[model samples]
Target: MSRLGSFAGDKMKTRGRKVRGSAYLAVPFVLLAFVATASTAFAATESTSKTAIFARVTWKVVKPGDAVDFDLQITNGARLGEDPVTYDLKILDLPEGWQEKFFYQGEQVKSLTLKPGESLTVTVEILTAPNSSTGIYQLTFMAYSWMAEYASTQSLSVELREPIREINLVATFPGIVAQVGETVQHSIVIQNRGESGESLRLSALAPEGWSTRFITQDKSEVSSVYLAAGQSITLALETETTDNATPGGYTLTVRASSEDGVVNALMELMIALREKENVSDFDFVSRFPEVTAEAGKSLTYPITLRNLSANDQEIILSVVTAPEKWKTAFKSGDTEVTRITLNPSQSLDLIFQATPPSEVSVGDYSIVVEAESGSTVKQVVFKAKVVGLYKLDVQPSTLYTSVTAGNPLTTTVKVTNSGLSPVTTLSIQVTAPSGWDVSFSPARALSLDPKDSYSFTVTVVPPSNTVAGDYLISVKALSDQYVSDEVQLRVTVEAPTSWALAGVVVAVIAVSLLIFIFKKFSRR
Candidate 1:
């Protein structure tokens, strides 16, 4: 055997040593004899009265209704004897509602054994009752052995604190069903059960593009709220789902937190896809629903004329209502078509051209086009805006004419306002070659409304001594608002018949006189 095992065996043998029968019978006589000498012997054993044992606790404070554990070290530091000693573990002066237990290693044990030059470590578990008072407590922990007639005591300080304050969170609806792209609203109840007020912060976690909001009792938004002790508040939560969110189950979490603790609730959202509506049959729509063009201008718009009925049909297209004097036509490609045949679900890209009259007002105007198939007719309206045109035109009644050199000739001159607005302060202007005079009847300026014409008499006179020839003159209407083109008027100037007659008479007289003079000269 090993030396340590042999030494332990020897100690066990010594403890089991048997006394002889005579020695055991004399126990009473020896005890009576020792009583007579006890006073003298007690003095010799007085120094051994102090046991060589020490104990210490590891920690101090614990909260009410909570379990606290501490390490306990017991040491037999003195060489009292050669035998192993057993010490009973105990606690004294404990609080009334508190319970204590001693454990050797991990098991509950009442006592522990230690040899000379040895120490033992154990755990002391203390449980505070739910109703324990909050205060500092002094506890005495003792390790004693009855057989050894020795004991050791250690003092410990333990504190019991008030129980923890708790808050509760309850959601009215934990799950909701919603349509895709819909907003969902729910409520949550937050209650404070503690004796003191608490400030709690609110937050939400959701997928991207989801929006959430928190509203209080007064319909005000806030990130946090203050709740008094034993008070409850209902919070409103509004959530918006995205358009592309899948039609399935999704989880959303909302949290309420404070400095003391945090709590959260889960919400399940089920989304359903919305249904689509069917399009109407037999529809006519313009590619460009609205158009802008100047007066007297033509604009063509492509229209999708569809026959959504489930059969072949013939449709006659015509213009029903339009701006006055505005011409409209329906054409397929480059050919004008009044009627067409379409199969089921057939559509034709027809070009619709509208020409607004030059006299049309400068504003938005609507044109309605009708399509007739059997007894059914569909009319589609389109908008056309006539913008202003700053233009004027001048035309002469007679561009070319004959005139006597000294006599005056008259012709009609027409001034037209081709613009959309009225032309005010209009005056006629005439340009003629040198030695020619031209004049208008109403020489002052006049006002003309859009697409309106003003007629004036133009008088032309050639210089009396002017040589007969062809001449040209230009006439134009001028105004601050409009100016007409310089229309050219041709005039052929001829000498007067009286001037021809006088020329002939003078010629005859000269000839007769010359004949007489020639006769006299011949006779001489």
Candidate 2:
């Protein structure tokens, strides 16, 4: 060995061994690779350390075409003094016509800002389309960070349930306007919103004793009907109120039922009477509408006149019409006046006096009282019944008479007029039993004054074939101006006088002859 090699070896043994040139270059490359790996790990850690944002409930059940709410909570998770962060709320991949809104404290918000370690709660409302299919749908609620331009998403599961049976009833006129004792008809539209057909029965509930009917579009009456899916039908609802029904508002709850469910709709009916003020601006009322009086007597009526107009009015009182020979006058406050001034909603009482003629007939009479305002006139009719002051009677002197068969008998009938007025055209009427003929001697009618009387001869005849018995006869005196008077009598029928006398003679002769024969036999 050389002296230099030996010295280098000693140095190598004393110190560490020397590196090659390529190995030195590879050291810098290894350090660069380590730095790149550490950077990648830091970025992965940052990405995983996201803010806490999640829904209160992961899934919910809802009905199609219905609104649902999702409660969401976000917690800052950042260290204190970190920069304020802004996030935008949105719904990702939403179906067309679907609505999604973010609400903060009952108000909708588009974006939210939070400081470090701060927390926020928001409500998310989602509305599905009317025609949406039924199934489980996954929807994403995204919160995009403005600083990082990164989106954080939470999943919400919505389960939609389709309706089995649904019906909607609509009316063009929900309220019916009518008068008392009137029938009102209205059209209603029925729409089936379910996916299947339904058989629905229609019925109405209202005040007791009210009549209601359902008529279809073709005017046919039906108790129940069939409807197709998504079909619409129009029907008329007729309501008839009683004549004595009061005036007010009536509520009707109409219901349509199927095997699945029942649906109800409300209808308001407004009923009012034909008010006297509606015809005219004034009204006339009487305490008593009808009166009974004797013939030739005067009658007085009290009436109240009301001003129903919005403004004051001057009413002219007059008599529209009355019976012939009747004089009518109106008096107010001890003075005969035909004019009155009344304030709005004010009323005045007046007297209506009428004098009837002395020769007036006994019957019903009507008087009309009229009130006239500017361009308006109102009239009221009052009824008066007149009764007679006298009476008529028919009497018979002898009620019964004995008559032979095939013979006639006559009886006297007295007809008297007891009324204060004369009775004219008095005629006689007779009614007898079977197999008997009855008539009046004077077949014509006669007139009788008050307190006067007339006698009539009534003849009765029994047929030959009639058995000996008692029969009833009725006699009546009829008058044109008064009631008829009636009287009843009885007739007894007997055998002929000639036959009865012959029987008595034959009995006497037989007894005498028997005595003579007995004496002759004893003498022999």
Per-model TM-score versus the true fold: 0.36, 0.31
Worst 10-residue lDDT window for candidate 1 reads 11-20
lDDT of 1 by residue, 1-524 (tens): 54323322343233111123456576566545634443233332223433343445544666668887777677765575867778877675566667788898789998888886677778888887777666555555667565323455555656666534567777767677777788877788888886557888878777789898898878898888888879999988888888787777776677777755653333443334353224345777787978898767897888887888898878889888887778889999889999889899888899999987666777898888988877677888888877777677888998889888888899998888877777778878888888677788787555788778888888888988878888889988888766777888888988888889999999999999999999999999
Most accurate candidate by TM-score: 1
Identify the candidate with maximal lDDT.
2
Clashes of each: 0, 1
User: For each candidate, C-alpha RMSD in Å?
Assistant: 30.6, 30.3
Candidate-wise lDDT, in order: 0.73, 0.75
Write model 2 residue lDDT over 1-524, tens digit each, in one string: 34323322342233111123455466556445634643453343335545677776978766778888899987667788788778788765465567888999988998898788888999989898777666656565666564432335566766677546688888888787677777878788888887668888888876788888999878898877788989989998888877677777777777788865554334444434442224478887899768888766778788999988889999988988899989889988678989999999999988888878766777899999888898887788889888766567888879878899889888888888877667778877888887678888676456887778888888888987778888888887888777665677988889787777998999999999999999999999
Candidate 1 accuracy as lDDT: 0.73
The lDDT, on a scale of 0 to 1, for candidate 2 is 0.75
